[model samples]
Target: MRPPPLRRLLAALSAALATGLAVPALRPSPAATVQVLAAARDLPSGTILGPRDVRPLALPPDAVPAGALRENAVGRTLAGPMRRGEPLTDARLLTGGLLRGYGAGTVATPIRIADAGVARLLRPGDRIDVLATPSPGAPFSRTVVSSAPVVAVPRLRSDQGALIVLATDRTQAAALAAAGSSLSVTISGAPAGPPQNDGPR
Candidate 1:
């Protein structure tokens, strides 16, 4: 037998009401997010960040990495390549903070590379041997510091030779200083050994 029209209407209304109530319970509330600076576009290693190089991104609190920067990323050099939207962190920039993890007695030493073209290829964290060539016709170059890790590669100027900062101990720093303008570098596989304190070898 067919239900009465009024009875059927009431049953449909009850079912609709139940669904409306359940929908709210099944849906979740929006999560809160925190804003942090991120790469605006694909950036190569050694790029000096500028205003347009970074943008603000909102991420879940737990998603944000330790040492992520909320601001002040501009003018900092990138330690490595970053994809668009990657969060900026202290570890990704070339700064004084980078030296802290290198250990005690470690110093950031700035040296001029004899070949600007060769220096241009270096990025942070690269292990290289600092060499000193005696002259234009020198048969062999001497290694001033073996397997020093490059920490920073500053932007080059037309009037200046390429300059790169290396993380080295006091002894290596002195040798690099003595090498001066004769400094050249060759990329090496891994660090050659623990920090050498016996002087340049």
Candidate 2:
């Protein structure tokens, strides 16, 4: 004995309740997270990672970097620079094949930066343009290497000078060697580091 409108209302409410219950089953679950090691500080290439250099992080599965492992990464050298908090991945670690893809004439060369301040600031993977004055007090102003990648920035020694590794051709290496003590450099954000001197390659 229900009216047509009343019967329709009852049917509509039943459908609404069914939809609300069904939606929970259809809802997507939260993605799982993985524990991985993340850099604790800005790490330059060639740096030997230490216990304090990294920390564990819980990251979403998809956000985890490839080759990332939760195991201790201490003592491993880096082949590339990493920003603080960046995930430490296998590919970024030092490997023999790192230089396999370089263009012809590329060679690893080490030079000493005259300025300790600049040398301290240089990190591996940094790009530096080499300039030489040719003569001191005259304007250290000749281009030796243009936009060369810093392969390594070795830890500075108290007595031993700071050494910066560069990727360049043999000829350019010779040029840098000759510029020794007269070379200067420029970097982004800071007055460029002093030019490198001829040091062991």
Candidate 3:
């Protein structure tokens, strides 16, 4: 026997509601959580990170990964050593290979000078200003000099610093390394103005 019209309509409406609700259930749910690696200690800016420097951040059980995952993620040091529990971001992650040139036109070069003593004062990752003074007897005694960021610090007893010259060309690198002992580097805040020769004579 067929049910009454109203009963049939009610039954159909109930089935439609169930079907609508079931669609959501059948759809795949997002991943509940993800693990992200972060720094475990204060990593200096420009410091290259290895497995040792990273720690993982696990999201809650219902959270999904928000961004692309880097399987072989490499982070570059953007600032000095970071404190423990610091979350890692692209700013601190090195996306490219080691010595991945950063800043403008940086390259490793040998800085030669007469006094190793002066070189000893500099350290890797230290910012400096390069000064040039023309030979005492050169005509047109204009001092041609430029400042390059130090990429590598000279080791104790080493006569030269393996510097990653910044904003410099091959010719400038050679000139800076070959100039007389007058070539002096004064550790300075990120370079200001053009290279200076007004330092104490």
Candidate 4:
């Protein structure tokens, strides 16, 4: 059948439009993610975490760190400085039995270093010798605990001396606790000497 050229052109155009409409548009599916606790802001070492300090973050399953904390981190002290969005891990908190990985019978002991400047230089994993002077006029100081590993250095307050947590046995912990405010520390690559049998009263 002979048709007008314009009418034939319009019929072809309508067929082309109908074919295009029949095909569905392609779209990619959303990726899967997992939730983990993360720091909400820049936090320094020794910060006791609270609800406002942490936030839940979604990340790819593979991107999640091993031992990442999914539960609340409240009441846990940070072992090191963490930037915003950093994931919380068990190793980062001073949890109960925080020294378990160090070895059996090791306890986390908190001690004050008389010299805040000296204590500020210490970090976790540093070996130190805790020394105590009997009096301000004392000529010499003695090592109370030698070769103790620093587990955490928490800055609690500016008005007080620096507080450091050390991994020590019961005996060393007792000596440190006894030494009280007269304590200072010396960082060492090796043991300074045998730990003194006598500690300041």
Candidate 5:
């Protein structure tokens, strides 16, 4: 019969080798990644997305941004500029902000405001009214837009003035655009009435 101490030594060695072999199997694997939409090239602000403009990318799980869904993307206009290979997030595309309730037939018209300070105070979802002045000091000033939803307040350089976007009807959009730089903005509280969203798109 084998000696008790010798048998114990062999059993210990057996367990040590078994544990060593099992270590590799117990080691966790790397986290799985996913394919997400990203800009193919340097996409400028206001660029309408096309199939060629964007492509799916394989990225690490941690790198995927919130709201970067392929189904939500595609065929949307960019509100802000994006560099090449930039991931497409919800904020990167134009639909959220003031376009919240009104879904269709709304035109995003970028208008320059007379007061940069007031424009800076304006945030998305705030309702505003726009006044137009015909000439520098003319008395022909009139209210061109009343209670309009403020969409995006774009980032501006130090030398640049404040520019904001509003969603309005086709005729209202045309009139606001045709008014030129005369648009002065005033931040009203919540809209006076429920959105006059035209029937059925």
Candidate 6:
């Protein structure tokens, strides 16, 4: 027989090898599940997303075999027939809420147009400045506010044209709508040149 210390060391080595082999089998395998956005109505460009825009989606949670991408793995796009009653991982979810609010205005207080047509021509994510002339006689104009990519253009209605909705209190909304109709809301940042006067030619 070997010495006492040598025999003990051999037993320890055997135990260690056994544990190493068992570890691989004990690990859980990946599943086939992913998250997706729920069906929602058309949200305005600058509208905020509440809790209604997100829902869970389930796929074959057991279909993801070993050595495959995990169900909870980030950036992995899953495309297949999904079924109910399976667990879903929320890795690729998207929300439609802006970081800041817009369009809430105050009453009866005229919100001047800052940069005129800038708001009307903006896309969903375009940055723009809101400039308004307080009055025709006012010496210099003022920049009422500045926002990023928050304007919502009217769809399929050329007659309505583009509408500029500013972020103001309830009263300001009424005031802006009322004042904008009469005031010449000239969009700024247009090709700078002499004004084209259309007199009877």
Top-TM-score candidate index: 5
Q: Per-residue CA lDDT of candidate 3, range 1-201, in tens?
A: 989999999999999999999999999998566676656777644455677877787666454234423345453433233567665655443333323555344434444444567676776555666665555675433333434555554242434422222334455555554664455566676544333333323
**Higher lDDT: candidate 2 or 6?**
2
Model 6 scores what on Cα lDDT?
0.37
Cα RMSD of predicted structure 3 = 13.8
Query: Worst ten-residue run, lDDT, model 4?
Result: 192-201
lDDT of 2 by residue, 24-64 (tens): 98989877999999899997555778999999989988888
Candidate 1: tens digits of C-alpha lDDT, residues 1-201 = 999999999999999999999999999999999999999999866578999999999999999999999998888877666899899988777777768677888877777775788887899888888788764666777778777888778665334467788888877877777775767788986744455433433
Cα lDDT, all candidates: 0.79, 0.70, 0.52, 0.78, 0.73, 0.37
TM-score versus the correct structure, for each prediction: 0.48, 0.42, 0.35, 0.48, 0.53, 0.27
Candidate 4 is scored at a TM of 0.48
Candidate 6 regions with alpha-carbon error over 4 angstroms: 1-121, 148-151, 156-161, 166-179, 182-201
Count steric clashes of candidate 6: 19
TM for candidate 2 is 0.42
Greater lDDT among 1 and 6 belongs to: 1
> What's the lDDT for residue 168 in model 3?
44
The reply for model 3, stretches above 4 Å from the true place, is 1-98, 103-105, 138-144, 156-167, 177-182, 191-201
For model 2, how big is the CA root-mean-square deviation? 13.3
Alpha-carbon shift of residue 15 in model 5 (angstroms): 29
On lDDT, the stronger of 4 and 6 is: 4
Angstrom error of the Cα, residue 158, model 1: value is 2.8
What's the lDDT of the predicted structure labeled candidate 2? Answer: 0.70
Off by over 4 Å in 4: 1-93, 135-138, 191-201
Best candidate per lDDT, number? 1
